[model samples]
Target: MAFNSAPKQFGTILLGVAGLGAFVLNLPAAAGRVTLFIGQILQALAPPWYGRNFARQLVEIGFYSLPVVGMTAIFTGMVLALQSYTGFARFSAESAIPNVVVVSITRELGPVLAGLIVAGRVGSAMAAEIGTMRVTEQIDALWALSTNPFRYLVLPRVLAAILVLPLLVLVADIIGVTGGYFIATARLGFHPGTYIQNTWSFLEAQDVISGLVKAAVFGFIIALMGCYHGYKSRGGAAGVGTAATYAVVSASILILISNYLVTELFFAQ
Candidate 1:
């Protein structure tokens, strides 16, 4: 019995290994397909640019998303300030908290949190809506009517995300730093004027620019994953659900990866 069980376990392990190898092999192809998809969308970028769809996408991804992003940023800033104070107080570096909070919020946390929030919220919605349309034959109907799905369906979403996310991140940076200021001054007994002065003085244009740039990249990734997965969804209802999940997960992972790369590009010595 043990021998038989051992063989079964080994077979299972071997199957898992094969699956992993297959994913590794297909990664390049998957990447190529995404590139091709973006290229086709660009090629389809002609007049009639679907102005209404772009407007709707802008409101959907940006306006509806603000409250959640704002809340998350404020709370994260509070936590970061409190946590930093713990370490900083020990080193007699409590005065640096304002500079640290401002820099960290504008340069890293603001863009990253905003991206993740949008990915989870707007990205999933795009995937599910498009996936449902795909399953319900709406996309086919559009194609039959001589409409290019990339232009009609995808282009607006991508463009709106690119335009709106930077704005969201900018708002988040301001709110996050404000939250930290409130915490440091009220809870930690910091001088309010000095804190504000340090925060304003220490923050640079490069830091804010880098974060906004990251937000744009993250927005593109989120929209791309959502639309791509939704477009490829085939198995009806269950496939739509899978596509939504894939959109959120992939957007989030790509956001983090791109965040690091952009940070390196901007700040690496």
Candidate 2:
């Protein structure tokens, strides 16, 4: 029995070794893909820019995403105010509600939530559009016509996202703070003037700037993941659908991870 078990144990060990080897090999492959994707972006920045396409994408990503971002921000701010009051009232610190709402929105929630909403809305759309082009051999047709697909399709969207997301986040910050203000004054029986003063006095320029910076970085990550997955898509329709899902998931995860890193950079003690 011991001799027979020895062969089975050796087989399991061999399988584990092979799995580890494959995992190690995938690291470099992923790195190379990232390198190539970035290279394409850099090259797209050269002459023969697609101004019209860039404008279109800007409207699509920034303007079109506003309603969703706005609603999310408004409700988030309201809830924050209500919750802050509930917790602070226990300690007789209800006066801190305004400060908490403004600081929280500007420092963290505004940019993060806006990025997530856009990642879900625009990122998936980008992946589906480009992946479909890839699957249908339209990308190959562009190559045949001497038109670089990255320059035509990828650059506009990426640049638009990088440029527009900060503005979106700024708007979200304002709307969120306003929502908090309304809920505090109207629903929670707080004095409007005092709440506004507390929020204004407690808020700093650094908070807003940090959030905008985070928005820009998040935007870049969102577009990068979408384009990278879509550009490399294979199989067929099923593959395009999978690429869309991957784009949203990857962008959302990167947004959260990078959010912590950026916060540490700005606020770490």
Candidate 2 residue pairs that clash: none
> Tens digit of lDDT per residue, candidate 1, span 148-243?
889998999999999999999999999999899999999999999999999989989999999999999999999999999999888999999999
TM-score of 2: 0.92
* Candidate 2 residue-wise lDDT at 47: 81
Clashes of each: 0, 0
Taking the tens digit of each residue's C-alpha lDDT, what string does model 2 give over 86-176? 9999999999999999999999999999999999999999999999999999999999998898999999989999999999999999999
RMSD of each candidate? 1.2, 2.6
**Model 1 lDDT-worst window of ten:** 40-49
Q: What is the Cα root-mean-square deviation between model 1 and the actual structure?
A: 1.2
TM-score of each: 0.97, 0.92
- Residue 196 alpha-carbon offset, candidate 1, angstroms: 0.6
